[model samples]
Target: MQRSVEGQPGSPVNYSCTHSKLNLLLNVNIYSSASPHISLLNLSKNREFRVFFFSVSKVTSSNNRHRPGRYSFLIQFYAVTTASSPMSASKCTRLSGALVKQLLDSVDSILFDCDGVIWRGDQAIPGAPQVINLLKEKGKKVFFVTNNSTKSRKMYADKMTTLGFDVKEDEVFGTAYCCAVYLKTVCKLEGKVYLIGSDAMRQELEAVEIQQTGVGPDHICGKQIDWANVPLDPEVKAVVVGFDEHFSYMKMNRAMQYLSQRDCLFVGTNRDTRLPLEGGKAVPGTGCLLRAIETAAQREAQTVGKPNHFMFDCVASQFGVKADRCLMVGDRLDTDILLGSNCGLKTLLTLTGVSTVADAEAHQKSGCAERQGMVPDYYVESIADLIPALQG
Candidate 1:
């Protein structure tokens, strides 16, 4: 059976299926007023299924209105089948074999999360380089989007090259770069930033002609009152937070003092709490420091990294990437997959990072609409799993 629905120009349209006995082989075709038509086919033998399709449109918002007529769309797809079948809540399907190529053929651009999707720490996952190189060779536009704010775009590209991946600086978008772009282009701040991040963030801010303070250790040297009365930079107009190995109490106090000003803007890289490493080891991520700053400042920060549309905007604006023709592959369900979900793109979660198939299943069964966004449309054991499909 086939159904057609016309969505509002800038709003989302939702449809649900509740028929228990009616088996559906879903084929979704999206037509945009400003773009060409795109079709997606889902062949499923299970008794229940869910499908997500992204449509392109021009959405006008306070932050994005300057770029008029640009392609953008936001849609969230969630379904809880009423059928008694065991696969009813199993939307996170394992991707393998012929299914891999079929999924790859459905998108023109693929956004990969670096830390867990391609490499772990300093080592690239087995067959990861082949999969990435082959995807580019197949005429696919590949981009790396990572929330690790400790590295700039050039730094990330350099690391990728050393790890045997085909990458370029412009194709890499890390929070350190995106946060700087956000401050310069979006915020249009005229002064310096009170930054609680790494040296790489300082480099990115400098690249955009934005000055920043608070990169190194800021150890507390005096009493509480002295810390409260600490000197502040009058030119500082924003408080930017990211991954900081040298995060200290004095730094948090300084950020709080700067943010206490009503006009001072607050921004953060991302909210990922843990950074997963090889052999299942993990460490604190930027979220820990950002949260501390938020607590002290009593203010919420405008984050520019994953799960935020701004991250996708950084890539889409540069490459003219359309939501309908893009796929987001990442390891974490909260940041990576949620970014894809937030931006109206297909989401694929690999088990090589923080989230697992069981975690996705819990969200699927949670019956919470918001948590549903964290559930990816598909899950894979590893990105290396795609090598065979690319080879074939």
Candidate 2:
């Protein structure tokens, strides 16, 4: 008698064995977040049952979107992927079997989501590197699109290389770099920026020779009255928001004060609400920081991230690719899938990230155009599942 638990790496599932260990066999497979089913195949004589796990984390608030580093990813999954789920025969086709060839033949280029589709946090998803490389070898143009503003294009390329993915700096299109490009070309602002983001964003902007202030910590000096008297950069003509580790009341106040001027432009990297991290934990994303400034300034920011068509334009215009000829692959329904739909590209949803099959099902049946953007054209249990198809 033996027992076994099988799951993908970074997949967390809790199992308890109460029965006597008389060589009982238990197999547990923690699949990507996209999978909505949990199959427990019992070879033992008397114990064969499937247990449903659906206890994932919750956002602290819809408006704030901040976790204060207090939420754990250990929250049970929102839904267990099942046969009727979005990617599972009910809503879309699985990119497997004969469909694999069909999928690959349909698109000349592919856009990928960074966090859940290819890698979770600093760790790489299984078989993701091989698939990306194989796609390129087969004449597919590949690009990395992420809403995360914490890292620059060079940094993102470095991380991909560190994790064994064959990627180049230009192939990576992050919101930080896009925001800088938009400011330089579209907005054509020549003055300085009062930034409420990390040095990474600052670097991206500075690379294009955009000057920035309020990047690092601005210590709270004296009292509340002192904040009112804090020196301001009169040259600042724009306010950009991204992931700011040093986001403080002082910084927020500074940004708000700058935006108080009618000529100041408000911008953000992306409005992604939650950032998925290691250990089943998550933190407030740039959206939260951006929203905070928006609330204070009472002005809507111009976001250059996903679902906005700007990120796609960055790749399409530069690489001479067409939206109809491209495929966007990602884990999140709202950002990745919606971005694909918004840009007129095919969308593929992988379960290894923040969204779930149930989420997609709701959108499919919602009868709302907004909700419908989330429905993926295809889905696979994991990006790894595509390896065999690419090989064939």
Candidate 3:
């Protein structure tokens, strides 16, 4: 079961903190264990996959047996983290102006994630553009790394410019472009690809001159069972999945058929399960489509986006930026925060997007490595809050 807590508009939230401090509404799912081993999961809006186990029987709770309000299991959240992590599992540091200045001095490159961090939907977050521009003025290298695969680099750059940021196409690093690069450099595919994605994905792949099919709508057949009769393309050696509004059973079946050959490679732009929409509404993301295809093919796809390490590689490898000297600022914890932790980069979470401080508090208690990865080294109320520090 899950419940939501609504807090302040732009304040750090903790799971156990007073409700007044939490402005943004967050959905949190608490797990209860029945077995000897307590299995805790971070069931949040991001669908983070941090799981851990500890002995529930050994827990010293006053109430031992299961009851209506009296719980039988002793619950403790175990988070995922490495021994070398300098971050404290007890708390997420609130960045003071002095700390922010120190962080700026230490990092040479700063990477920003779009959507929640810079802006929510079409409206740009106030002061975001100024902070980004200020970083550039200070001789700091800035880049935009996004898990959103629906748009190409040019499209992202255009959107950023429209939002009043000084952005260029070369500085935009989105999953769609990274997937194309992965296919060309890592996969080294010369044959055709069976693509299940948007036109932007097609644009990126086409820019790299990678041949593909299955871009538009899949026509529904008169016969429900058309798999045996449908012809297969032997040249389709790779099956790439991204955000595709036209994804259907036919597309999934065709992708599976090609993937069933064993030689065909399976790839995905990212693993984000849901896209956070306006008015608290959310639609299925590329992960859903990829899962459908994977279910049909009975094979796991190699994801090229956030928390996968490949996304950061796109920037680090191309720009020669040192991970240790870089800072990653974003809104989402599961993707942005985890990506920063995965790449050994300092992470700052802005609550302008999906995750709130309460989410970090929950993970801190868990001690789960995966959940710990989602916990940022520091957090700010919003990206706009950085403006004052930048001025200093």
Rate residue 168 of model 1 by lDDT: 90
Q: What TM-score does candidate 1 get on C-alpha atoms?
A: 0.78
**Which portions of model 1 show Cα errors greater than 4 Å?**
1-90
CA shift of 296, model 1, Å: 1.1
TM-score of each: 0.78, 0.76, 0.77
Error of 3 at 185 (Å): 0.2
Cα shift from native, residue 14, model 3 (Å): 34
Tell me how many clashing residue pairs each candidate has.
Answer: 0, 25, 17
lDDT of 3 by residue, 1-392 (tens): 12223221111122331122121111121112122211112232121222222223322223322221222333343334334333323337987677778778879999999898898889999889999999999989999998888899999999899989998899999999999998897767779899999899999999999988999998767575677457877778789999999988888878888877655667889889999898899999999998888787777677788866677778888898887689999888888887776666778999888899999889878956447668788999887777777887
Q: How much lDDT does each candidate structure score? A: 0.76, 0.72, 0.73
lDDT of 2: 0.72
Determine the backbone clash count of candidate 3: 17
Best model number under lDDT: 1
Stretches of model 2 off by over 4 angstroms after superposition = 1-91
